[model samples]
Target: NFEGTFNTGAYASWGPTVANRVPVHASGPYFIENYRAKSYAVHTNTPSSGAFRGFGVPQSAIAQETAFDLLADKVGIDRLEFRIRNALQNGLPTATGQIFEKGVGIKECLEAIQPHWARANAEARAFNAKANGSVIRKGVGLGSCWYGCGNTSLPNPSTIRFGIKADGTIVLHQGAMDIGQGSNTVITQIAADGLRVPVHSIKLIDGDTDLTPDCGKTSASRQTFVTGKAAQLAGEALRRQILRKANVSEAASLEFSDGLIKAYEGDTSVEIELTRLEPNAFGYVFMAEETYDPPVKALDEKGQGMPYAVYGYGAQLMELSVDTKLGTIKLDRITTAHDVGKAINPMLVEGQIEGGVAQGIGLALMEDYLPGRTENLHDYLIPTFGDMPEFVNLIIEVEDAEGPYGAKGLGEHVLIPTAPAILNALRDATGVIVAALPATPDKVMAALMAHNEE
Candidate 1:
């Protein structure tokens, strides 16, 4: 087996050289610099290395999150307060040296959790106060992060097909698979709105590589913003064509419902069946396609540049108790606030954020990957049902002008900042600083022994 050590602080940094020029000025003493350090580098000794769930994030997460805990202890500051002081705002620059043009919600997310955090911290402190001689000492922590939604600095794209069939039913051919994120359902909503037709009447053709156009991968949380918008644009193009043929003198705002267009003129209304219109009355039956690509620039030699078209932010807090003697950490509950730009699907967005938080908690407490044997899920360890606690969601809607329907990618961003936040809280609960990953029983025991001796 090949051995390698990844050090983030090794070099000044590489890539997107311009990110360093971006300014970060905050009112609080917490000043953040936009420094784009290399997140990771694959050693050549291995033929391949990657995984589903979280390919590279968990690896980097363990180190950075633990570092935050150390920083809080060294400065003798409340973990959450430190995080709030350094929280990223809309005008602030990112690590990659890019200035967020829109959809920045880091501060809003933290503010949303203020009440929950205050209550939880007080309850945790009071519980720990009574346990004078107990071996178990309870603790909690928090983490935050940012990431781009779609492919950056590389060619990535998505295409959507819209057609007015001979039968008059609006047909949509989506090039990307749903991948369990309800892509099909959302795209249908976009098409229905675009074509001015009922959602029930819109039947989407499954994503087939041969028949469909080149819409990039369904990953990176881009299906909604990219493919969804393409479908909407194509549908609108067709609707405009149909309206031209109706030859109505009066103009009206129209919406599609139940396979008909509801034309409204200041309370005066009329409904018309889309299929009943004369087939050849217009020159064309209306058909079109479109694609979307978030703007991004490649990183330069110093690891700085506008590497991402946009960035998403989140803040999360956790309450837990640790058995100082047994070295077992018990989490009470978690509250999270995320800026998702616009919740195109509110239910779906919440599900994504909550699910990611659970994974982040696992990373902070249990999930650990052995360098040599990466596939051992059982031994590698992950959180189970017993580990799950109450989850309070604080959803923030900040409209993104560049995103489709005021939307941005929420997939990866949900998990980025969670681990660090949890780790910070853990430090606050127990006067211990964990400097490594997993925080397993062995590690916790060692840290506790050292603390006691000191």
Candidate 2:
């Protein structure tokens, strides 16, 4: 059973949305015989609780995973081993009763990190065994996450438009904002692949209302899956039009250059002059606008349905040392294994993982919101580059049938496991469980004192 109460402040902003989303994700990616989840939005006299990276799921995961640690200890099973055994596999239904026949990769992620978990724990034990009269103790812990790719049983759709001008220059009017998540690069790559053209040959336009279509808002890690699918469809539509005009077979190869198109299939070649053709009212000889709404079904009163068509899965292992006296944690390493369906851009995925890990550090050790009392940057701390540890990334791919080129969402999944992993590591170093956000030095010291007294 899972229950959550959120202090959605004065305005209540996205409280209802979050209230609905948390319960659906509260189950994580594990299988249970039965579970009931309820969420309450309590009015508070604090700042407005707006949307963050993981919505309310991160907080729910922190509570759930921390509880799992206690359960694992009580059952005499290693924490990582316990999760792997219980990790949701293919054909296992979710809390919503949505059973995926394929594209379920939580168990794969947990298994992928097994070697890393072994190494981290071995190093920690060896270091702790030799720590005689030392104030520092090493510990390692694991955390896993599974995130649905879109909104919770809502009508969220993405539309993309692309057209070839008389000069043969392709202008892709995409509405999905980049927001530093590499949507521009990812969407363009998908579009290019679908259109059978070079990425650089196509021009991308975003945030321009007059030129771009409504590609939906940039959240829930939906751009790569939703908007990208739309872009792929649009590109295919435009390619089909060109093929029809040339009277070429579907197997024909395409070549797009300035003011012309060349279609070749075995000895049959067809050329279309772009400059000679009449332009449409949108000022393009050929254009395609396609919309893709991820298949979803509204949950019943019991919150059961296909809330999201695709989901991302991940596991992470963190190794750190806790200064028993100072209650400070020094990071040593972190290994993250995630099933992204497919990586459209490997470097961007790595950047996302590293950035998410940094945010996870803040959520685990700092970045506490104190409402009225905490007004300045000094009051709220964040992690910097100097705070990062040795990072290892393991990209897992379990292709989704609905995704474009077998690509799923990666933005939110990377951060969900971070905070819990850090807290679990802290618990390993000092037999104290911190389910709360931002385990500050004072809180750590207090928990340590309690452990010592016990």
Candidate 3:
């Protein structure tokens, strides 16, 4: 039973976008039959609010996760076990009634963190017990989240084109923007596997509208799932053409190297010289263009439908020390489990998870934007190098039938559970529930005083 209203203010007249998403995501990634939420973008004098990392899920999660923590305490259930009992699984319907036949990994993510959660809880209890009336107290908290991969049940498609040149070189027209998120590397890896060639043989030309097809924008965590699938299909299509030209069976093993293509089947082999092959209409030995769109059903009047083809699940645990007298929180460690369906590149996935955790820390403790008072970087602070804590990232691989090579998006999913986890840990340490965000020292002190009075 939650209700919300989003005020985009003056820009609501011109930028009335994402107004539909606030309510849709306010349900917070669980199965709720009688849930209802209302959101509106009203005109005001203040600046308009725009899209950020998790669309509206992070804001919704703050409310839902806080409530879940209270509910777990009320029901006398371990927080982790309570989440596991209600964790989404395959064949279950979401709040929007979207039924997923596979790729539901929330339960797996929760289960993966069981050992870490137990150990951390025990350590925190021991440390707190030893403090014995000291101002410093230690606590551990957990948060779980689920994020839709692409646009909610809308036709957001990606197109990719690739060609094999006369010199046996592979050129991939990757239209997805990297923006330092490693789309260039991840999509290239998928293409290389699809074409069955060494990764070194591929050359990438990305984010150039004139040279590449429309792979869509690099938002909504869609590049990895949508563009990757397009690249995979294009690579497979080019491979098929190459196989046909070599006069080899589909089961035959093919190798490309040194300006030559070789296909082998049993004791028989066929070699095709790159110099002798005829170029196609695109002036290449083989070329392919493919498009991929995650299947989704349109929302009806009630804003319920198949919103996303796949979702990424994650759970994070935070261990921290809170100083009651000084009203300061120091993070010691973070344990995270992410269900990415498959890790196309382990390094990239870990980097994303770590980066997301940093952002989450900032949002939880320091970063707050006020138009007049905090207009610049100095006034609007963020986490520094000294603010980072020890990190332990766990990768959970639950095969996704619709993903490229059984892989899903991990960009936005990394941070969804972070802020809530930190806030919950603060509550555990000080017994103070922060209703507002960025629980600064002053706010924490105020909340502590209020709780003490109560």
Candidate 4:
């Protein structure tokens, strides 16, 4: 028989303890169950809760994924198999009672990771069965969670402008920022392909509010899909305008390439330079602009809504070692699989995954907030070079029709499953379970002590 248990946690929002109302926020109530107990951010004399790298997914994964490893050990099931059996699919209902509309790849992700997981799990098990002779036990664990690709319940939109200059160059203007994730490059690619122009012929003016359209913030992985589409539509519109102004026949299609507009059936072609395409310039012809808006709704008191326009999924496996005495954890290797719908840039997607895993490692063994306070990054520690582990980044490309070229956002999906995976491995190695974030030496030691006492 197939079986699984799902748990969730919530954050309580009391507007400062002095406020005379019960905090009805979903977060406080949501995480307590996942934490195997309750945790409250009582309207303290301090600050409130907010989103970070992994959002609510990280908090939830940290608890349930740890529990998953414990459950796997008890059932004697392969960890990977355990995950696949319970992996959320497209039609599955989420804990919040919402059905996924499209682009769910939780199963696909598990399938992609099967081979690597088998090999890694074998190595971890073999080493644990017979290796260093000590109280220290080496194990492997995993963590995974689901979240929509962009801002949920928040207004998400993008606008872009495309114009052809007198010199035949294509100019694209957008409000998206690069921030190191290649947003600018991808937007240019979409415009070039749409206008039929050489990639290099497109000049992108982006992230300047005064010079570009309102493309929304760069936080969510929405730029490439949302803003990129706007750029493409604008380019297509400009292409139509050019043909209309040139009085070309319907059959006189124009091929856009290398900044040149050529009559499809004739030797006539004109190279347009972006500088010469200024609206104030003589003979400057076509201009087009467009905006994109996806349907979304607000959740009522139930803490539900079309929070995400689209969702991205992933699965991961970890091979790790825990020194029972030293109370230190070592991550030997990690195999991560994600469904990105389309990898506009495979390298870029890999980068996003790798970076996210780094953050995950931090959450599992290094990152921590000072007790009773969320402020001060200086006081809050995150993983550094000492924590980097071997990573097997796997990109499971499943074309998402709503995304650009079938590409969905890969930004936040990578980190969700890592901590749990590692924690599970730890349980496998030592037959002991630690339930909390940053399973530090002190915490692990405490668990070991408690186990020995038992």
Candidate 5:
């Protein structure tokens, strides 16, 4: 059983929103037959807890993954094996009773980490054994997670508009905000591929309400899956129009070059001059507007529904050393495997994974918010350059049927498994489970003393 609350009653009467996410994400990613979770948004004087990177899913994952580690120890099963036994797969019903016929990669992610897990365990054991009377102890821990791509059981759609200007220029209206997550680059690539045009030829107008259509907000990791699909469809639509005007079949190869659209079918060819066509109201000879909404169903009285069209899966392993005397933990390395369906931009995917790990390390070891006392970076600390460890990201490509070019969302899923993995690693090193978050030095020392006394 799990219970959570997000209090918003203090300002609810004034139109403040409540905790709409706690109940949906409290179950985490695995299936639970007899599980029970209760969540609430009550009135309080403090400000409301709004959506963060992973919404409320990260909180839920912390609770569930920590509990699973403890449970695995109690049952005398290998932690990794324990998770594998309960991981969701095809034909398994989620806690929400949503059963996926395909594209469930939880098991594959778990398997992908086996070699790394074994190596880390061996290295940690060897290091700890040699430490002898030294205060340093090394350990390795694992975490697995799943995340739905879009809004839970709701319609969140994205629209994309692409046009070929009479001046032989291609313009794409991209409404998704980048926020430094590389949305601008990735979506443009998808659009370019769809139009069969060079990436440099496409001019992008992004996030301007006056010029672009609604691609929705950059949340729920929906841009690559939803907005990218819209871009893809718009590209295809424009391509079809071009081919029709050239009187070419789908098999015909088409290219845009030197202000002319050329189509080739074996020994025959046709060319359409860009200047020969009249411009539309949008100032383009060809234009396409398309929208995509992931298939989903609303939740029932029991909170059961097709909450997401697709889910991304991941497993991560953390290796670290603990100093018993100083109550300090140092991370050595992290090995992560993510089933992204397809990586539209591998570099961007790696960046997301690394950034998530940094935050996860902070959440597990150092971050704590004290309202009055902690005012700035000095007090409310985050991971710095010296705090990061070596990272290995393995991109797992399990195709999603509904994703744009078989690509699912990777943003939120990267961080879901991070904090829990670090917490479990702390337990492995010190032989004590720090139930409270952060596992700060004081709390870690207290838990160590308690374990030693026992």
Candidate 6:
């Protein structure tokens, strides 16, 4: 049984949303049949609480994963093996009672890092065995995550609009906001595939309501899964129009030259002269608009239904050393395996992983907000370049039929497992559990002192 009380702060904001989401995802992407979770949100005299990355799941994960470690100790099983044995598979049901017929990759994610787990743990054990009462000791920790890609059981839609002009100018009106997550690039790549044109050929337009279509908001990691699909459809719609005008089959290869489209199939070829065609109201020879909404079912009061069409899963193994004397933790390395369905851009995927891991570092050790006093960046610390650990990125592809070209939402999934992995590693290194957030040097020193006394 799991119960959570969330301080919603001075106003509502996403307090109710956080309350609703915590219970559904608190189980840490594993199979939990005899599971029960409840959350209560109460107003406090602080700032209003809202979505802080994992939408309250990160706090729950930090507790849940550490609890798993304790349970593994009582059962006399290796923590990694214990998790692998009960990892969720293709036919299992989540805490929400939603069954996925396919696209379940949590087990794969856990297994992907198995080889490293043994090697890293052996090294840590060897190093600590030689520590012989030294202030520094090494330890390894494991954490995992499973997150839905879009709105929970709500109608979230994205539309992509594009057109071909008589002058052979191909313009794609991308509506998805690129809030540093690379929506602008990822969506364009997916659309480019459908249109059979190079990415450079498509002139992209965004942030202008008068020019762009309604591709929906950039939250919940929905731009790639939802907006990308819409972009694909829009490209196909225009391609079909061109094929019809050329009186050619869908299998025909298209070549754009000057202001004309050449459709060629075997020995037959047809040229679509753009100058002979009439422009539409949007001032294009052919224009197409398409929308994609992920399929979902609303949850009843019991909170059971198909909340999301696609889910992203991953696991991370953290190796670190704890300076028990000074309460300073130094990350050695982090090996992460995530099921992204497809990586439209491998560089962007890696960047997202690194960025997420940076945030996780802050959440685990450095960042602390003291309201009036620690309001500024200097007061509240963030992870510096020196704080980042060496990363071994392993990309897992478990294609979901719902995503565009088998790409799922990855923005939030990368952050979910990070803090949990770090905290678990802290425990492994020093044999102490941090019962609170920001795990500052002072708190860690105190915990170490109390443990030493015991």
Best model number under TM-score: 2
Cα lDDT tens digits for candidate 1, 314-388: 767777777777777777788878777777678888888877877877877888765567777777777777787
Among the numbered candidates, top lDDT falls to 2
Off by over 4 Å in 5: 7-19
- Residues 55-126 of candidate 2 have per-residue lDDT tens digits of 888888898887888899999999988998898888888999999998998888988988888888888899
Evaluate residue 373 in candidate 3 and report its C-alpha lDDT on the 0 to 100 scale: 85
lDDT by candidate, in order shown? 0.65, 0.89, 0.86, 0.67, 0.85, 0.88
By lDDT, is 1 or 3 better? 3
Better of 3 and 6 by lDDT: 6
323-412: candidate 3 lDDT, tens digit per residue: 999899999999999998889999999999998888888888999987668778888889987998898999999999999998999998
Question: Residue by residue across 1-454, what tens digits does model 6's lDDT show?
Answer: 8899999899999888878778888888889889888999999899887777777777888888888999999999999888888888778887778888778888888899999999999999999999877989898999989888888888999988889999889999988889898989999999999888999999999988898988888888789999999998889998998888889889999998789988999999998889888999988998999999999998887778888899999999999998888888999999999999999999999998899889988998888888778768878899999999999999999988888888888998888888889888888888898888888889999999999899
Q: 1 or 6, which is superior by lDDT?
A: 6
Over 4 Å off, model 1: 1-31, 34-36, 44-47, 51-62, 72-77, 196-198, 247-284, 371-377
**TM-score rank order:** 2, 6, 3, 5, 1, 4
Error of 3 at 78 (Å): 0.8
User: How many residue pairs collide in each prediction?
Assistant: 39, 0, 1, 38, 4, 0
Estimate, for each residue in 341-411, the C-alpha lDDT of model 5 and write its tens digit: 88888999999899888878887888887656878888988999999989988999888889888998988
lDDT of 5: 0.85
**What order do you get sorting by lDDT, best first?**
2, 6, 3, 5, 4, 1
Off by over 4 Å in 4: 1-42, 47-50, 72-76, 92-102, 243-260, 265-284, 301-305, 371-379
Provide TM-scores for the models. 0.82, 0.98, 0.97, 0.81, 0.96, 0.97
In candidate 3, which residue pairs get closer than 3 Å at backbone N, Cα or C atoms, i.e. clash?
A: 153-307
